[model samples]
Target: MLVVTTACNLDCAYCYEGGGNGQGEMMDLDTALRALDLVAASNQPFHVQLTGGEPLLAGELVFRILEYIRNNNLPATTAIQTNGVLLDHQTARRLHSFGTAVGVSVDGLPAIQEQLRGQGAATWKALAMLDSERVPFSVTTVLSSRNTRDLSTLGMALHSMPAASAIGLDLLVQKGSAAAKIGVQPPDAVTIRSGVTRLLATLDVLNAQRSRPLILRERQTVLKALGRDEARPYCQACTGSSLAVTPRGELYPCTQTLGDARFHLGTLDHPRLSGTALPDGRLPKREECAGCGLQGRCPGDCPSRLHYNGADGAGLVCALYRTICDYCLYKGEIPS
Candidate 1:
């Protein structure tokens, strides 16, 4: 995971990159290549995600970096997380050449999307360009109170888009720009669980009709619902095998800790690397979280948001997860 630049062309209200005033040092082509070389030397089945204030802003640079990775034979699969605002026909064609899987961060339809993501016309046009180019891309929705009510609308909108290969939903991480003013905060646990349940139901219908899979990221909920893998129900970011590098060439445990300097590891160009070197100091389960039956499955919610927003480790939004988990267990869907 690497954030190439802190700069973004759009000032989205819920921009999670806190320092992302869109004015940070951009990694030059050589810098990016050096990082890739370091990953290759480490002999790790690496995965790198290109993110930014907006990665597509560095379109040509991003393309060159991917080319360097392929040419060097790095054991890596690259993904780009873009706002889908800058993607045009030409750029989409270029991205397809690199064989990079694109994940577009779209919240919902024009009315809802513009409210949260802003730059409505641009994002819609970008999606159109992707569809026109037949570029295989996916949509990632940031589920929030504002968008929760419109989940079905969003699903339908994405379903209508032929180029979309998948749909993913992430609970709104209320921090940084997003927390400042979205007229709401991260929903209570009950709301998150209920909304996810609703969204998943809608997705089931969409998936049944289409060859493309609908991705609701309801793993924790669905897993709990089905009585499987309870303890590790949600995103086990650190426990999961993944690495992320920042634009400054520093490696971190994951992307959630990218902007923060404390999690910095050695630069990517160094000939020396250690698999066990990076720290995994994410919030440990508090007493409240530990006693809960769902604790075994949850990664304890979003650690970054908890750290940044001074949120209690146990939040109302998390209750929704617990509810879903318990429901699944009661139904004998998941193992006790």
Candidate 2:
């Protein structure tokens, strides 16, 4: 992942980047190119995710990087993670032309969106623009105490967008503005389980009516883990296969660990692509999870969140995965 810039246009209540206010650094063309070269050196099929406080804030730099990928014929699949407020018609067209996958951060309906992201109408407009331009995109919602009850409503709204292909539920991380704020806390386990249960039922009904099903990112992960012989790491960062490059060319295991000198790998000038030596690089065995029914069936939670929330983090993850896996078993969605 490449954090093109930390300058965000919105002051989201739970922004993990600490509510960026357009006063952060932007990546230079040379640094971005060098980062791409570093990834290419791995000699592996890799995915490049262009993310930021709001990547569209640096529109020119983003387009240039996309152009570089195409012109060089780099062996990489690219995507952009945006807040969707700046995804106007021209931006949507440009993204379509580049054939880059787009993931938009939108918390739920208009009211919830306004409360969390401080922009609702613009996100709706961006969704319309993406649909109009035939840009298939996914929605990522930061599940928090604020919007846990509204998951079903969000699912219905997303079903209306023809270009919407998936919905990814990101449990709120206790960092940034979220940690400083009073009301912005991760939802309790019961709220998550109930909210996700309703969401799963809603999606089931929605998928039955549509020719192309709307994928649930968490459910997909659980399904894959269930089919595997043993549990796999939750994300590429756990195995040290992924790196997040900041605008200043600093590298970390992933975006969530972008700062924190402990996880910092190195700078673009002198790269240190060590595997699993970083603090959160390797997945640690949790004694608390031993002998749990869902132990092996679960892929585990985010290392960054675990590091931040400690024991409470594991409880949240267990609630989420257990709810989804139990729902699937009850519905016979997969063999028990």
Q: Which TM-score value belongs to model 1? A: 0.81
**Model 1: CA > 4 A from native:** 19-22, 179-184, 224-242, 266-295, 299-302, 309-317, 323-336
Give the runs in model 2 whose Cα sits over 4 Å from its true position. 275-293
User: What digit string (tens of lDDT, one per residue) describes model 2 on residues 1-336?
Assistant: 889999998889877767867688899899899999988887878888999979998989999999998998888888999989888888888888988999999898888888888788888888888988879999999989989888999999889887899999887777777778566888998999899999999999998888789899999877776777677666777777888899999988878876777778888887787643334312345664574445655778778877766677677877787788888777876634
TM-score (all chains, Cα) for each model: 0.81, 0.94
Per TM-score, the best of the predicted structures is: 2
Q: For candidate 1, lDDT tens digit of each residue in 120-239?
A: 778878887888788878888776677766677777777766778777766555556665755645655556666666665676678788776655555445464345344442343435
For every candidate, C-alpha RMSD to the true structure in Å: 3.9, 2.1
- Worst lDDT run of 10 residues, candidate 1, spans 272-281
As a whole number from 0 to 100, the lDDT of residue 170 in candidate 2 is 84
**Per-prediction backbone clash count:** 22, 0
